[model samples]
Target: MNEILEQALLYDFYGELLTSHQKEIYEQFILEDLSLGEIAGDAGISRQGVHDLIKRCNRTLQGYEDKLHLVEKFLAIKGKLHDINRILDEYEAAGDNAGKLVADIRKISDEIIEEL
Candidate 1:
């Protein structure tokens, strides 16, 4: 996955675990795509303070991911859904009996849903 996209996903899954101040700084840096100096100016902090806060936020988010693995499971389920879609498309193109394929897809979908 792309680095920024991965960061966004991680933040999406775990950002609420951070304090309000941390969330604000993290959103400025990652979601808003602000430079350190810009964030510092807006937050009334030094550039180095902004940098350290971002680093701390990254570590805190990673810790949540490490404990819960929610992001990993989400990505896996997404890949499985994509694969199922591709299989359905192939079956439609071939005009074949896709009953067995449908059953397998349903099983996989159920497993993913149960994981959540």
Candidate 2:
């Protein structure tokens, strides 16, 4: 997957850990796909200030992930799903066991997502 997509997912997964103001600015910059200049214009800060804000926000998000391990857990679950998919798809010529494995994986993934 793309690094940008991963970063975006990590941000979302850890965003609630940040202050509300940070959330608004970050969402505007990342999820909204707005440019730094655009965000700065709305936030009444300089463009460089907006850039620094985003950089600091990214660091804060990473800090939360490092401490809470929430992002790590989510990423691990996603990796497990990918592995399960590859296993099922590659053994398409196998018996019903693959179908059962896929079903089990889905069940486990659903439970994990619920906990998240």
Candidate 3:
């Protein structure tokens, strides 16, 4: 996965667990795409302070992901859904292969259930 996307996923899954101040700074850095200097200027902190805070937030979010695995499970289920969609599209294009496509959908659905 892309680094930014992974960071966004981690934030989405566990950001509410963070303190409001941490959330604000992290949102500025990651979601708003602000530079450290920019965040520091806005927050009235040193650039190094902004950088360290962002790093700490990253570690904290990653720790949550490590313990919960919500992000991992979400990505897996999303991929499975995408696979099922592709199979459905293929089934539409190959009308004669309806049985096979139905079986594929069933298999993916079972995997999704197991994941949950």
TM-score between candidate 3 and the true structure: 0.82
Clashing pairs in 1: none
The parts of candidate 2 lying over 4 Å away from their true place are 1-3, 90-92, 95-116
lDDT of 1 by residue, 6-52 (tens): 78888999888889999999998999999999999999999999999
| Per-candidate clashes, comma-separated | 0, 0, 0
Q: For each candidate, what is the lDDT?
A: 0.86, 0.79, 0.89
What digit string (tens of lDDT, one per residue) describes model 3 on residues 20-90? 99999999989999999999999999999999999999999999999999999898877878787777777
Q: What is the TM-score of each candidate against the true structure?
A: 0.82, 0.73, 0.82
Alpha-carbon RMSD, each predicted model = 3.9, 3.2, 4.6
Q: lDDT score of model 2?
A: 0.79
Worst 10 residues of 2 by lDDT: 89-98
**Candidate 1 weakest ten by summed lDDT:** 107-116
lDDT of 1: 0.86
